[model samples]
Target: MLLQGGAFSACNLAIIENRRLPGWICNAAPSGRLGRAHSSRVMSVATGEQMSKPHAPTHQPSLANRLRLGSLADDGLSYKEKFIVRCYEVGINKTATVETIANLLQEIGCNHAQSVGFSTDGFATTLSMRQLHLIWVTARMHIEIYKYPAWSDVIEIETWCQSEGRIGTRRDWILKNYANGEVIGRATSKWVMMNQDTRRLQKVTDDVRDEVLFYCPKELRLAFPEKNNASLKKIAKLDEAAAYSRAGLVPRRSDLDMNQHVNNVAYIGWVLESMPQEIIDSHELQTITLDYKRECQHDDIVDSLTSPESAMTESVSELQGSNGSPTSANSENDCLQFLHLLRLSSDGSEINRCRTEWRKKPAKR
Candidate 1:
């Protein structure tokens, strides 16, 4: 017998004995695949005989399952996950934007915390932290990008955290192209606890330290070793007159995260807002180090100020010693560096200080 819409064909009709009345129950299959039965159903009859209801449809995985969620690495100390670069994540250059990369790093870090049972609330806060109204705040971040993945490219990220000191912890990440297994980027960040209500920094308590250290590895493993500390050195404050400035920059509603503060990634965008267009077009960001000084709210008006390190003669000479020759001092291979400052427009209080290194873009063939 054919079912509704003639899509399913019923077969193997069986007689069932019922106290009320007799009814027919049969297995149904798609009309095209009649030999392969998929579901079972009972026909409705005039007399009340226990009607066999249709079995529930087979469970199927959702589209979100396509995304490879974070899981512990084989060594059991680090967390790793694969992400497909979505169309929206890419910029006009057809590669993932710096902000997108930063967001991914943040996501994997949070996921690592949650996997270790440290994040009871959404913000990677412990149960004690929630009770004490404490939250983690980033103090410093340094990121280096060798390559950026284009849209639809699959990239794998591995991240781990370790105790920095009595009051702080550090997290590091390594990003790679999943297709060719090429290392593309690495990032490290320092975070400290803060009192959510008082808006002041807090030291890591003994309870929190023990809980976090339990998951950290015994041996220290750094993506950026100590020898590379030159690139991760402290970013000097941009004290000179700003060469470029973008004032009245307001945070969009979307910029605020679950913590009710402008996210770190948004600050990255604001820092770039004041960058000279010629630099943006001619160079690609190689390294960026951000020292977050204060948090910004949605209503806070901001001014993004930038100054090229080359303009500071003494600083440039110190960075790249001059050999009494102009050509050697300003070689093409020499990276262009910039200092960026983001401050509140109202009182000029500093929000973030950034140092960026850029390399000349390769000429198109």
Candidate 2:
């Protein structure tokens, strides 16, 4: 039976269709895999519609029907999916949160890998990688949001991956307002392989390279082009002498992902834990760049440190110079920028370093 606003179990898989009434049709099959199951129910939480009759157990959705949920774009190199921003995914501002946006990016990236016949054992790993006990680890990520979608808003996300030299791969995404096709945000990330057992960085093997390259686009296309790529610059490392710090931050059991480590999105929340209340209240995150250093376990204690970019002039002057100085285009367009760091409390080893830029919220009319 359909349950309004109810969470799907891990064993159930839900495929969303954008129709007159957008809704999820969940199949209560084992491990969330699609199979010959007649116990499926339509979940239309947006309009509170009644459950539809169960499909015949012997019948299966056509490939075209399945692709409607999420499919490779016309380019054949990128994958696109639509998601309705659920109430739980929004914040007090009645808009989607940064964590929610990051989660959607991760979801689309995984779906793109799956669409191209990659091994499902882990995040975008190939069958050869699984045999070698290898996994992908994020190296860097940069995201910029022009606008945040509100609750119930349907947003379309497209993502594609390309080779980043012999040691890493790069993935880029474009997020759009599905109703009007307005670009809402764009993000790019870099990832490298690692040995699951030894935790050492691994080079991309010829087998693995050939497997993924076959699906990549022949010509290079980036979400953020390099000509006007201010966001592509390297993020400066925040020092230990940050003015604000919150220690003893622990990851909750729910914070871990399939890799049995703290999810990358969780680190964003932890980084914000030490942010000044004034900034959090008066401004909204506009751009953020994260450089992951090492993984954090569930038991590892973390410390979040933050400092205003103005305070780190000595260390970041070169970066600011390269990006060009901020100008007074509009007095109301002023922004607040900060450098952040998340480190283990045990030996003070770095976990991640970040830079965040925020814009003042428009005054309520």
In angstroms, how far off is 112's CA in candidate 2?
A: 1.5
TM-score per candidate, chains pooled: 0.75, 0.76
- The digit string of per-residue lDDT tens for model 2 on 277-313 reads 9888998887788888988888999999999886322
Summarize candidate 1's per-residue lDDT along 1-365 as a digit string, tens digits: 00000011111101111111111111111121221121121222233344354433232222332243645554346777888999999877888889999989887776555443344343666545666898888888888777778899999998888887777788888888888777777788888887888979899888667656655777887777645353467777887499999999999999987678888888899999999999889887867989999899999999999998755222122112111111112344557888999999999999999998777754431
Q: At residue 73, what lDDT does model 1 achieve?
A: 55
- Cα-based lDDT at residue 305, candidate 2: 96
Cα RMSDs of all predictions?
A: 16.8, 11.7
Q: Scored by CA lDDT, what does every candidate get?
A: 0.66, 0.68
Could you say which candidate leads in TM-score?
2
Q: Provide the lDDT at 345 for model 2.
A: 94
Clashes of 2: 0
